[model samples]
Target: MTTQQTFARRVFLVAGIYGIAALLPQYFMEAQVGRDFPPPISHPEYFYGFIGVALAWQLAFLLIAGDVRRYRLFMLPAVVEKLTWGLATLALYAQGRLAVFVVGFGLIDLTLAAFFLYAFHSTRAERG
Candidate 1:
């Protein structure tokens, strides 16, 4: 495969794997997450809401992976999604609002964000 195809496939695989793999654990650990989480549970809305939004974005990533050019516009929002969680995690971690687990999650999001950015730019360059 050419480098462009390779990169596209890599993004697709990474997103697909992460989208599918990551949620199962969260699903199993849903109750425990509330219990083990550092803060008191004020409302389940935010928790469930986050999960819903995250899953939706994961679906978007999977869609983008299917056709990088057609879904190119979505990458902008994808980056925003990644950055939202990533920056929040880091900021929260820095302020002692969140645990290391969240920080770790943030770092992974940031890493993925980097790959997504690269994929976006390179895809454009390759096509243009």
Candidate 2:
């Protein structure tokens, strides 16, 4: 397969894995509430929000990479968003508010940053 296709597949797989993993804690909490698995000390709304953001970001990358020629413009926006999220995550971590879910979210952002950097290099190589 083409490089773009390969990259897209990887992104999709990673995103899907993360999405599934994100829901695991919630399920465990429900299945073992007050027994084996205790409810999180903090509310889960922020975690869920991050999960949603990760899902959307990954899906968008999959779609864009699959059609890079037609969606080249999306590259800039994707890079900007990824960088923004990364900085935000770092700030949160610095503030000591980054729990497991936030760390997972930060990981996703870091992955995106790496992928986008590779993609940018590849695109530039093709252009030159």
Each model's lDDT comes to 0.78, 0.62
lDDT of 1 by residue, 1-128 (tens): 45875686578568767866876566556578767984545777776677778888888888888778778778878888889989999899889889897788788888888888888877776553
Candidate 1 local Cα displacement, residue 96, angstroms:
0.7
* TM-score of candidate 2 versus the correct structure, residues matched by position: 0.56
Top lDDT prediction, candidate number: 1
What CA RMSD would you report for each candidate? Answer: 1.9, 4.9
Q: Candidate 1, which ten residues in sequence have the lowest lDDT sum?
A: 22-31
User: Which parts of model 2 are misplaced by more than 4 Å?
Assistant: 1-5, 12-54
RMSD of 1: 1.9
